[model samples]
Target: MEVASVLHMNGGTGEASYAKNSLLQQKVMSITKPIRDEAIRRIYNGKLPKCLAFADLGCSSGPNTLFMTCELIETVEMLCRELNHESPEYIIFLNDLPGNDFNNIFKFVECFKQNLNTRVVGGIGKCYITGLPASFYERILPTSSLHFVHSSCSVHWMSQVPKGIENNKGNICMASSSPLDVRNSYYHQFQRDFSLFLKCRARELVEGGSMVLTLTGRSTSGPLSNESHYIWELLAEALNDMVLEGIIKEDQIDSFNIPVYYPSSSELQLEIEKEGSFTLNRLEVFEVSWNAACGEEHNDNSEGYKVAQLIRAAAEPLLVNHFGEAIIDDVFHRYQHILADRMSKEKTVLLNLVVSLTKTT
Candidate 1:
């Protein structure tokens, strides 16, 4: 499978909105603290050796990444100090898809240079920011080197879309119909990618090292449902309107598909079990409340829409490929409208999961 960039609403050349969304940041930390704490505990108890390395996979650029990394380091550092253990030598690795905006991340690094020494007890540990794709974990870290790994809002995205879709008999373009096949294909790909991830990370994680991962997820036997389908459909409808207006060709829309997947906890558990090298420590579910791009409740004077635009910009390539560039703005507008309406009718919720696992010694 060729690794392609996943459509992200919060991506662009400048700053990402999610990177600045303090509310979202707070919510992420609230859900991720327990997982981080557990990983720290494992590292402190000799379950994972002390003075070992730590990393944050898919650590996108921005305040969010900096905030997350600093928080994780603080948590681990505090635990080590409390236990009278040598503060673990930390290696902060920030990874993302190849196309991620590194400039912003670099800027963020500069902002933290002064505070780094102050944050660590003994001295500032080695901090490095580098890029790594979702598939090629082997190249990112050295063998048997990492003690704790943390990832959030990542990993549900596949390296690429499933194969054999062009010839498939059903609605291959839309994720609503043929969900079983879609999910199965997605599961298979995740199984392969995750297996490779473990294999790569396994080489880098010393005996008993642990990983904490959080990502978007869905619950149901198979395929995403209609309620969940509204977002895509609204975008699709906007694209169709653009087509009618002679903005882009219909064929163009048909050629594009999102190369991502949302897995259920059961599906993930099954795959992890198959890996056979890690022990599941904990799994938890939560719903994140996201204000729509055009929510009336949002302070209209705020920078919320700018953040939404950034996310849309990141997703533009995929959206244009699928829906056509001509309809992109319309699609976004319609999506915002639909999202607002849905929120008005009832709260729109996004499902997410956080899991912690320890490598077998």
Candidate 2:
């Protein structure tokens, strides 16, 4: 399972070009709009159930999942009109990895029900989008029936691909180049996929539910250098320059890798306090500058070099399937001219964390 075969051959070209680039949808909805406005003010101050139920967990599929599900239903209808309550019954869901792109997220939920039948926010009413594929560490929800669980850039991804890197030789990831045996084998598979995603979202959350997790991490803790392991050494030097131009074959680069995992923030608060049903309310940390012109100087281009050329055009078909398509467009045009000459010499950085838990029951 080469990470579920590169998510079933790049899950519909990574969720249909995840909203055809609007500067990577404002760097993933500007860090997921303050964790969806603090999980709609802690589910309207813990009153909870209004039949709300939201879930994006690895959503991925066009128009940045309807622009982060219309900014999480306009921040849960402005926290149910500042807690007066009532405007609920809005289940969204939209997970991923069952070879996602659920028909382009159900055609972007029928263009979000024809743009909410002609948009009318403050007037409320309209946001029922649904499209669950599954694989959020695989429980496929439904126990207590969630109340909110957003996920950006998906849970530091890893449902596979860390298994004993073939008896470790070519470094089976722990941030390779062997840093303490690949960070104790990437923190033992990020503590077994974050304790089976907090025991399957704590049996599908309900008791004071709430979870917001943005990803792409690493703010020191050993290994991860060479300019923060520049995207796995620029995808293992574009698959060893496509196996030295023979076009894929060195045992398919020792049978590919990259299920990815990048925790921090005290190793994700020690796996959400050893899966005791969450609590951490926030763990912030931001720096994302994929280099282009570290924000500003827009007209002169470099929205992080056009979101690093839409993540190198959605990782160009897994970099031309282990580098081949004639040296995959000259190795992504020399990796976008060395990431735009290292953003004109200020180097680059990306880190990012953004937590916010809750659950506790």
Best by lDDT: 2
Clash pairs, candidate 2, are 19-63, 174-182
How many pairs of residues collide in each model? Answer: 3, 2
- Compose the digit string of candidate 1's lDDT tens values, residues 174-287: 366544565567567777777777777777788888888887677664555432333454455555665678776666555555565677788788878888888889888777
Candidate closest to the true structure, highest TM-score: 1
Runs of candidate 1 exceeding 4 Å displacement: 5-26, 47-50, 119-139, 167-174, 226-230, 292-314, 320-327
Consecutive 10-residue window with the lowest summed lDDT within model 1: 165-174
Tens-digit per-residue lDDT, 119-144, candidate 2 = 63554554576777667887887797
Positional deviation of residue 163's Cα in model 2 after best superposition, in angstroms: 9.2
* lDDT, residue 123, candidate 2: 49
Task: Name the TM-score of candidate 2.
Answer: 0.34
